[model samples]
Target: MASDKSTASLTTASSKAILLLVVFLLTHTLSFSQTTTRTYLVRLRDKVSSPYSVSRPEQFLSQRSIQRRQKQNIAVLERDLPVNPAYVTQLQQAGAKVRFTSRWLNAVLIEATDATMTAVQRLPFVTGLEFNRALSRPVRSGGRLGAETDTKFGQVQTAINYGTSQTQITQLGVDNMHAAGFRGEGILIGVLDSGFMNADEVSFLKPLFDEKRILATYDFVKKETSVYEDDSHGTSCLAAIAATADGQLYGTAFKASFVLLRTEDADSEQQVEEANWLFGAEYADSAGVDVISSSLGYTTFDDPSQNYTYANMDGKTALCTRAAQIASETGMVVVVAAGNEGSNAWRYISAPSDAAGVLCIAAVNQTGQWASFSSIGPAADGRVKPDLAARGQGTIIGNPDGRIASGNGTSFATPLVAGLAAGFWQANSRLTAVQVVEALRRSGTQAGAPDAQLGYGIPNFARPLATEEPMAPFVVFPNPFSDGEPLTIDWQTINANASVDATLADLTGRTVWQYRYQPGKLGTLTVPSLNLSAGFYVMTIVSGDKRRVIKLLKR
Candidate 1:
């Protein structure tokens, strides 16, 4: 009994000592100025019951979002529901001004005075509170975008003349993917960054505006709808994915749609921006976005007390990392920059990039060599980070001032991979978001032997598409078979004498239809109708000893 008491006392003393050490470090580092208002991450105990229901998700989720989840076999759980309104109202009544609420984390970001926070803590529903930062006026953090350069690399062409952007585009075989007609059509990408300065007026990107492809824009920092008035960093990042200028510049997924979100604040390096990112992620998820491409990363904060150490890069420590993981889990491909800290004292990848579910991209030059400034990593937990590399060094980008220019940073590399992912996903529309991430990694140049510097190395977009279907010897046209249209199966490669046996099954593996036929005569088979419901199905075909399984999406 005495020994048990002693152990408990020792543990208590050690925790207190650790808490004191933290206080001392905060006091010695950057001190906070006297401020009346402070922002906090308020954790709630329970979601309780809300106006939304899991049975009727359309009340809270978009129709497209519901379909994505349905196709992925992901359930609509209580966690997907919004926070209890009564809880938020109670917090507001307690003098805490709500900034944003995260359904995934079941928390609220609120700005409140010390006395108001004390009152908020007394609320029965309040579980805990984490101080984010003081609500002080912003001080500009010197522009953090990749440095623009005058030197340009040599260009090469294939089916499309990319001009200055050819090397970067071809390095990843994105041009070949484009040649195959998968130019990211129907894919919706959400870009969360600092801001898009002149994206609204940029010449190469004007087509997106004119075509109504710029679906939405939101500024989280300023809490506004216009994202065209802030930093130019986001504009350049967008150009790396969606810009289109014949012989001068061409983005990898130029035909895809986009949602512009300003989640980063160029004027400050604070933890609140992470909260803003979480908000952006939730918005992207709710908007039925297929991909999230974020060029922003976080490491050190203006308030030193909130700075992260290398130990914090464990994929689960930071809020943004957790949010990125959740976003991936919700069936969105999360792509992030590996950061430009390779030469800095803290030479490592940043949060969100460290997230396991996210595809972190490193930077390589036009020559396919690792860029010196591209952040390196074996995530603190020992997982190979920067799952892929792309041309970022002297890569062509569109300037906010409407000029085509070259820049160097993993920021550019990220969107290059993001665009490729958009196009790749367009080609493999039946694959889940997680499968798309894995397919990209498998298509990497060094996929057989990955490393920290370049991870799996630069991806080859054309390789996977070719390898995935070469042995099948068959093709399905109008794959996501539209209603009132015939589903056609053409076999042009297999021997005419081969016997074909095909079976179609629902996602649950129950066979719905089967057909036995000889391709020797017609070489094609047309089914007028299968009368399938709107969801994903699997079709297995066996020609002699060879077997092939194809995923089919029925709409």
Candidate 2:
């Protein structure tokens, strides 16, 4: 009987050992699976209601933000609320490592194994899921990415010389606006791009730093605080707007305050970057920015399956475009690059540019001709896109290394236009964001006849500042005269002794032609055409304190 009990005990020990080994193997397999988990974008259907209230917007919005909305008659809606904390907890409970959350899209990015993802999808709040690529590798220190390069470093000079930037700013009449003391003072601008490498160290941007105009910065790509350590594209874009030095170089809105945001992942092109852009824009809105300048556009991605077709250029199709529209509705003027795809296969304006009510900028050369690489557009809905054009080809930029160099892309044009828009708005403080946009469109050389290639044509900042008088009714026929055609002006002179003076100036406000005449009782005056270049010209008609500015396009 003792021998039988010993045999039973040995059998029990052997069975227990086998059971422990099986459990260890299963635990190791589960650990391996978790480590190999993939990242995904999980969209939630709704958020928990307990923690947030749309009526109490002060909790989420700054005082300036609240003031801006009040001025524009915009309401703080439920969409502006932060994502519910309960929903995030639920996602975390499902073994999802949350990376980012977008209140605008009501979505959260998570990392989880396939089995865990399956479980996450089965949750009641989960509406859908998509595979998001792994985080892009961080750029190596001092490495150049995209169109930014460090070759121009060490070439910076101390004296003020305008350099190659003069042509770009002068062509848009931005210099005249500067002369009027409207250099973006009292205005806040948000610059959204990949990175802002060396911006703090550049000489031209020293004023922005010295005056503490860089109000805030955030990096959405790496989820870090160091935007100056990444790509230099943002540096170039900012230089186009806020870089200022005595005579050497000056940006369009040199005196404006700034909020620098790193929204793009320069290492990779993906849809996730668009979400980052949306988040950045929302942040900008909450900070009370008057304008947003975004050089990034989307259509193609590293994953071909995630690429957007031309059909998606519809104003609301692209997620970023919807965000831009919302931004416009929220009272901030948004400017975007029309795109540099003119020479590529997908030759159309990219999204956010297609968004309605936003100013889409196209690239033009110093000669005021459209750049070959500037994307063309009639948005999918048939609205003429690229509301304006700016000098982009060979645009001078203050590089990260303190050197001033030239770069080419619509990316440069967007900020040039954005800065000038700020100055224009500064000149007329009473103009709403929508009114300013309309004024810009009307100030374009081609306002009378807009086309897809150049949209309304290049904008003239000075033209928008002209205040109209109700005294005399003046009209110019065949206004967009050819180089050799005659211009006929008819006006109802309020006073018989009133002298009529006509001046034709280039975009720089330089008087190219001037004439003085006394209108007859018939109220008609015809001037023979003089030699003029094929470009945009401002025709200012002044008759005894009643002045009118007419934007003319010469063929």
Candidate 3:
């Protein structure tokens, strides 16, 4: 997961004082139980005959969320409906403290004793319960829980002077995107990590408060609104995306709106943190966040039985992976770190990072070389894992004490790519979430030969935006076109009398097929006979000064 340092080992008196207050608040809110307690993920039966309706999505979803779904033409499915409130109340009545409910999964997270869970399972609305975490003693609420470690080595924006941060910003071509006036304005990024620490006090981040860009904050661990006193790890992650200090530092998406969420508990390692991530993801989706940058991951937990193996990285097993998939389906771009486990026993990418459609970021150094510590993977199912790379080593970041620092980890790299996603999407608003993911992949340095190490390699944000209007009038169909079939191009909306030049080139930029045509009244051009071998190819279409680049796979 994306956490660092011993949260309880703070040296500063101010940090200790803050921890005391957090401890006091947690102790007051939580009742101590002498018996062993376990958290269970309660899977609900269904949303049958529920008060909520897909037609009235406004009742359950925020207007912005509704608009995003509508914009993507995504239907509000039954699974999107809220879990029955009656079920939650029943669980509470049965002595289970309901912590969170996931609309997409139709489940609730509750902390309960075995006896209480027995009562909870008997409820007619309950389908099943999965054991998450067991607590032998009283709950460990404060002082960093979970181990998603990233080494401190570190640690910028656009026309906004990115002093020490310039290299990172330009490495991904984010500077060009910003120069094009797409510095993530109007985009909402939800950051899920351990804590924000003194985000409000950081000079570069104060604008988030002054400009009211911080739309919300939540501590899933403590069940509170305050996330400012937990850990400094998240402060650095946020700095990668939102910090703005001219010539000193700048985040890729400094102008974007934000919602800070504390999902990783830095003090303990447990499956419950994954559940917390699910809750945070659900919250981000409901809040209409355009992108989610989570630097956390789960692998081995405190309980050996709860540990995830490489097989579990298949994207279908981990709870957080499922949440990532659902969040992407809901029109939110999900970005996560590709664990810093390289050179370790478990060098594979972590869960949620393995989730398909999510951009799993790997770490690269100042010169764009792969960081030996950045995780590597073929996912467990043999799919390219680390979807992109970004500068992480010695990356510039803002500190809680109102200073700057350098850090190292896939943790920092993850948010830089997330920031790029926001700015790229803002510049190309017509693209769907999936399209956004693909555009970034296509812009990668190794897009044509993506592998486990760096997946598609580092992405150049300007590459995609500079290439074409993703939703242009021209359309190419049967994307993975089967061999021997005609390749059709529909330019129905293009200029009627304009001559179009279409060239299909192999991955190495070798033009294998070329077609020149003036559209018929119908504006359809078909290449009836192409004797090309099966492989990946790039197609460039030029009609006057307007050009479009398309990647194609022939089978």
Candidate 4:
């Protein structure tokens, strides 16, 4: 069953996926208990009212919806793409009937023919059009799973990415909590992946099982009596994310409980396979998953008719889109793998990963260079994707036979980050889903500025959430400074040759005051004592290494 991880020279990790698959079938393992399953009631509020109106649903993406709408008349369009609310306005103005509107995509997914499509394209502000063929019947892929050790489910790794050889997976942050012995005990995590055959038998996950932390696992793929029998991918993915050993490989969130969902169907191409993920995500919500980490994304399939062109990659183009959106709104941290189609002409991050609100992940090698297999992003809507990274190729995780295998893929990278997320969650359960997202982004290497390839850059838990006092003293004061009497900005000591610029800016493009200071200066820069109207102002210090911005109110 173990095949080389090569697929058309597709990229690295192809060989690794196979060897892990083979080791999976060879090991016979113990089973997991089916007792613990947390259920969450998924509630959707009215869109125009309440918190749901402003930030109810996060809009973190857009991609792919550019394909020519399929001309064939199909009944699913009603369920596929709902009528646009704005289109109703367009139709009424054009002397057409306005009946119903779509609250979802904010545009009408009309049942247009070739002529209608052409006419609609000519309409004003019609950003894009799509076929809405996403509503396919659900089909089980394959899920071979079993229970493993849950003993160390309480031990969380303090590092962002812990590699093999007992070294922290990342270089930047410090693991203060792990060092303090609070490694996420009693937290439950749900992992949705391909399959898990021998993962339960592996000794790595044995501790968690013994500790009774692995709540419950269901295989949506087979709709089976157990999730520990059909595939190896899910098991392997989970192992890397949460596995623990006796001075062996360490996981990110070792203490978190896990719910495993088998969504990918490596068997055949049917639009429903994509829909199955929707159902799985719904199930995940029902399962009360604190965190949902899926390394799955969709693009092309076996059926040419079902093939998704790059234009259709917009987060709104697929059935998985809504499901992913719903998952995010429900407050479950959703982490998805950016696809590995980077080198291919069809390469781009896949759907759901392109979905709004969830954190899309990219892969990076040990040397900190972007991996060639890691998909590039800027979702269809131009939002930076791959919000973070972890080790992919050469990432070491435990095998069922009590050994380790170095693997690769945005898949592996995803689990590693997911595990890190678990650790973050463990460190602070009071953190809301959005707050957690902000903290992760703010703690990244590229926090101040982000790009398409690595959204906010790598997630660093230690720095953003650190509890210790600042190493260098700094101050911003007199918030709500009335008429700018005198806004004093204090300076602090810093490294050699460091300089700072203190400036005050008004709402417009005008600068009120700008002052530069040397590294060791211990003085305050006063804003021009001008009688300004009530408004918002920005005071900032641009230092040699870092620039700090503080918002001031000019009352």
lDDT of each: 0.84, 0.80, 0.82, 0.58
Q: For model 1, where is the 10-residue window of minimal lDDT?
A: 135-144
Estimate the overall C-alpha local distance difference test score of candidate 2: 0.80
User: Which candidate should be chosen as best, given TM-score against the real structure?
Assistant: 1
Instruction: Please give the lDDT score at residue 119 for candidate 1.
Output: 92
lDDT order of candidates, top first: 1, 3, 2, 4
List RMSD in Å for every model shown.
10.7, 10.2, 14.0, 18.3
Q: Which residue pairs collide, candidate 1?
A: none
Residue 53 in model 3: lDDT: 96
TM-score of each: 0.79, 0.76, 0.77, 0.58
What is the alpha-carbon lDDT for the whole of candidate 3?
0.82
Q: Candidate 4 clash total?
A: 56
> Which has the greatest lDDT?
1
Full candidate order by TM-score, most accurate first: 1, 3, 2, 4
**What local lDDT score does residue 36 receive in model 1, on the 0 to 100 scale?**
65
Give the per-residue lDDT of model 3 (tens digit) for 27-75.
8655444244777888899987789999999988899999999998999
Superior by TM-score: candidate 1 or candidate 2: 1
